[model samples]
Target: MHCIGNGGFFMWWWIASAAALAVLIVVVLLSSVRVRLKYYREGENDEVDASLSALFGLVRLRYKVPTVELKPWLNGIRMKVAPEETSGVLPELDFAREEIRRFVQRVRKLIAHMKNYKRFFADTLKHVHVVELRWDTRFGLTDAAETGMTGGVVWGLKSALLGVASRWMSFERLPSVTVTPVFNQPTFRTEIVIRTRMKVFRIIAIGAMLVYRVLKRRGGWIVWLRVLLGRSPKESTA
Candidate 1:
């Protein structure tokens, strides 16, 4: 009878220890974690001005078992722009066209970089656990002049796993922008907000770790194969 009792106690002790360890890991990850960014620029002669700000972090933790609940959010991304003073309608039209061209070029560059980075980080990214994300964003433009213009856009994404192994995971961005000449002063404004809840499963985490090991070794071979096939070496193997 005593031996049976001791065995039962041992089982309970093991369970308790595991629970404690899990809690400790979560606490460590949550401590001292914060991300923020802000920027502003104004021309010396008040001809042009712009500003932006953003923040991301955990807001709450509800539970941790079967799945861990994390309230992660990103918000307060705002921007504004004002046109420079110029004489003649032709000059204003030219300035607007130039600004539109520059904006398109920047977007193209950003997309290209994102694609390259995703390919470069493929191997390492595969090991990241799945997450449920709730994202939201808003964009707006305002104009109060001879050629007034105004518009706003909102976007949202939910419950996504990020990695090549997860064939369903995907991200896309489509932007529609236009510029027109203004007889008077011109102005533009935009705002974005995002909220998310992430849950990680033990099985998925374990699988990710195992996959990472294999990917670390297979990465070189994959690159070589792509080269032999006349494909870009940076292409994602997964």
Candidate 2:
């Protein structure tokens, strides 16, 4: 009887030990899961709570070309104004021709100014067509490899980018721009359009780091689990 009781006690102790270990593992897993959930929750909350000023405080002038290019060409037509000795008409055609001449001369000066900015000129003169420009912006994730958030790096990037664009168009010589405000959730983008006398092309600077910082907190555990399960993230394209 004593021997049986001792065996039962030992059996119960072993079962208890197994239960304790299982509980410990469960607790550890639950704690890890809780931490991750909290991280994602905090990340999402911060993203939602982020102000437009914070997200887009950094402004870049990505490209500034003469967005509008104008060339001077005569519309082929001649006006004949006649006021002979017998005719009592100071013909309106003469006034119209004079006004057109003045307009052509003004356009020539503007085109010359545009030429001083770019080395290469378009080899064609076409009719004035309005090519409507639209502003596009988005909120999304970018891989960390492609984006950066350092002040010096951004400054250098801004300088180099604008320098190249300046070689293409004289953005500084353009008139003042008016941009309409657009309020968006967590992100905002503004579009400005103007009827310019010169061919003007503009490139808005977009910062890669603007949205990258907000999304880097996901996937360590998921990555581990995938590896444990004999799977892995697919290799990214080179």
Candidate 3:
């Protein structure tokens, strides 16, 4: 009887542990994820910073482009990537072109595996909330008239972008925007920051559904296997 009692205790312990684990998973999936972006440009210096954090920073990713003002015509563009206090430089234009090509190819592959990518992207992004947005720019030209004209154009562009962005996302707060025209000396500077938040569960759910649909397609698994093996779509075995 004692042995049976101990067996029952162990079984209950296992059941309780499983229940606790399921609760924890639900909490994590429901947690909020934050995305941030900062772009700065002053004179010839420009840089972009981006980060993502979730569960009070337990899960985080930091990405930055140290110098975005590379002169492609003078000495070829240089891209500085720094992560974990380490930096690597690559030719900016060439690297960007290759990445864009791969991205396009990936989109095409996804379309072949799971048709209707437009719907997924639109649906997923629509749920993303713009929690904060701030943009400030200062510009100047030797001529006052030119400076005024440019400032108006900049303001117009900012308004147009905000209008479009608002249609796609729910803005938690009105964007703080400013544009100053300095006519004394010829100079220009701008800074833009945006913060977004979304529920981790929704994103994961959508992505999982997309993956499930893709894997259900004919030979879809083989398509990704080739990609994993570093073989382009053109490569085939008889």
Q: Identify the leading candidate in terms of TM-score.
A: 3
TM-score of 3: 0.81
- The per-model lDDT (C-alpha) reads 0.35, 0.31, 0.80
Q: Where does candidate 3 clash, by residue pair?
A: none
Instruction: Find the 10 residues in a row with the least total lDDT in model 2.
Output: 32-41
lDDT of 3 by residue, 129-180 (tens): 9999999999899999989998999999999999998888889999999999
lDDT of 1 by residue, 1-238 (tens): 4455888999999999999999977765444322121121222111222222122233422211111112222321122222233223322112244444555654443333332335434533443332322222222233333243322111112122123235533222322223233334443333222222222343345446444443465353354344446554245353
* Candidate order (TM-score): 3, 1, 2
lDDT tens digits, residue span 92-177, model 2: 22234445665565444333333222222321112112222222222212433323233235446546654664454334243222
Query: Which is the winner by lDDT between candidate 2 and candidate 3?
Result: 3
Highest lDDT against the true fold, candidate: 3
Question: In model 1, how large is the Cα lDDT of residue 120?
Answer: 39
If scored against the real structure, what TM-score would every candidate get?
0.26, 0.17, 0.81
